[model samples]
Target: MIDEEYAKLLKQAELDYEDNKKFIMVLKKIRAKSLDREFNMLHDKAFEEIDCLKCGNCCRTVRPIYQQKDITKLAKRFHCRPIVWEKEYTDVDEDNDRIAKTVPCPFIAEDNYCIYYEDKPKFCRDYPYTDKTRLRNYLRETMENSKICPAVYLMINWLKESVNRGTLS
Candidate 1:
């Protein structure tokens, strides 16, 4: 069963996604430096205000791309062979990259805690990519991720406000 807060966040995320889509092309043209500074400032401020533990939405909805090194580390952690890990926990993406097959990462416990919190992949640790270097791509992906991540919703709202206030310019 989904947590109540998670459900609410998902609904709000869907709405935010629709609202933010109209700005994509314009956002794509934003200068990299400006976008980066704005993103960093916004990310810092937003994170200070929001608590991810209140809603571990990302862990509950998406898989992180796992590099070969990550696979090796995870396999070692589980005391399983790398090939066994690949067969049991992951699949090759369209690009032939190994990624978790299960959404809501298999390591997420029933209680919303990560079974491998300390050993989670780099992608998981740096999620909701907030750097301006990939703002266009981030926006595109975040819009889709809003279906399951409240952090995306919060980020979108922050972006909208920043844009309106001319801080993002």
Candidate 2:
């Protein structure tokens, strides 16, 4: 079951995103001591409470881009040639990047489980891209992912609040 408070928090974050975005842009550019540490703390906290099994919006909504090297590995899982697997399972997006052919991903089970969870692509494993960073480079992607990853949505909102309150400095 979705945690009711987390659901409420995400709803508020989505509604507040546009209003909070300008500030988030500024926050993104600020390089401060322990900033990534602070962000990561919140990221870890959110993950503890928000279960992916309760929400697979990332898989249902966005396909992870598969780079060529990963494609060969992914294809091997099915015991197929990379070229054949790409033809059968993926297509090039507008960005000329390869992505899954289907929405609600062919690999995602009905109960929000990914059939490919163990051998999923790096991007799938790193969905929301929250862990690694140069925070400045991640600003745009962070904002976009906030809606999909509850952890991101919560962390960004908390960051905005802390920065505005002069507490995170």
Candidate 3:
């Protein structure tokens, strides 16, 4: 069960999701080139004070897409074939993306440490994708992630505010 305050925050993020997408679309047209730098700064600042162990919302709610390499590696870790691993741990989404089958991924421990942290998927290693190069290209994913990761939510809000203030332009 979610606490009331956090649940309300999630509700607000859900309400903002579509609007964030639209904002990204606009950003692409006008501010694509400089987005990476601004986003990297925001990502660093957000993470500096935010301890993810305190809120494992991303592991709880987001389904990470698994790459073929991830599938093979994890399969080996589990002493299984990739096909068997996929069948047991993953599912295909509407986009035909191979994502984790469970919410609150089975590998996430109760203390918010990933049981498979060292061998975690590439996507998991680079989650939220805000600090990556070509931030504009991943805006859609970032917007979706904002709903689950508070750091991302804060980054997105800060980004919008910076743009509005002409600081990120």
Which candidate leads in lDDT?
3
Instruction: Sort all candidates by TM-score, best to worst.
Output: 2, 1, 3
Per-residue C-alpha lDDT of model 2 across residues 94-132, encoded as one tens digit per residue: 999998888767888878787877778888887776666
Error of 3 at 160 (Å): 2.3
On TM-score, the stronger of 1 and 3 is 1
For residues 45-134, write the lDDT of model 1, one tens digit per residue.
767765776677788677788888888889999999989988999988889888889987879887677788877888888787774465
- Looking at candidate 3, what is the lDDT of residue 31? 64
Predicted candidate 3 versus true structure: per-residue lDDT over 110-154, tens digit per residue: 888889888999988998788888777777778888888878888
| TM per prediction | 0.85, 0.87, 0.84
Residue 108 error for model 2, in Å?
0.6
**Quick one: best TM-score, which candidate?**
2
lDDT of each: 0.75, 0.78, 0.84
* Superposed Cα deviation of residue 27, candidate 3 (Å): 2.1
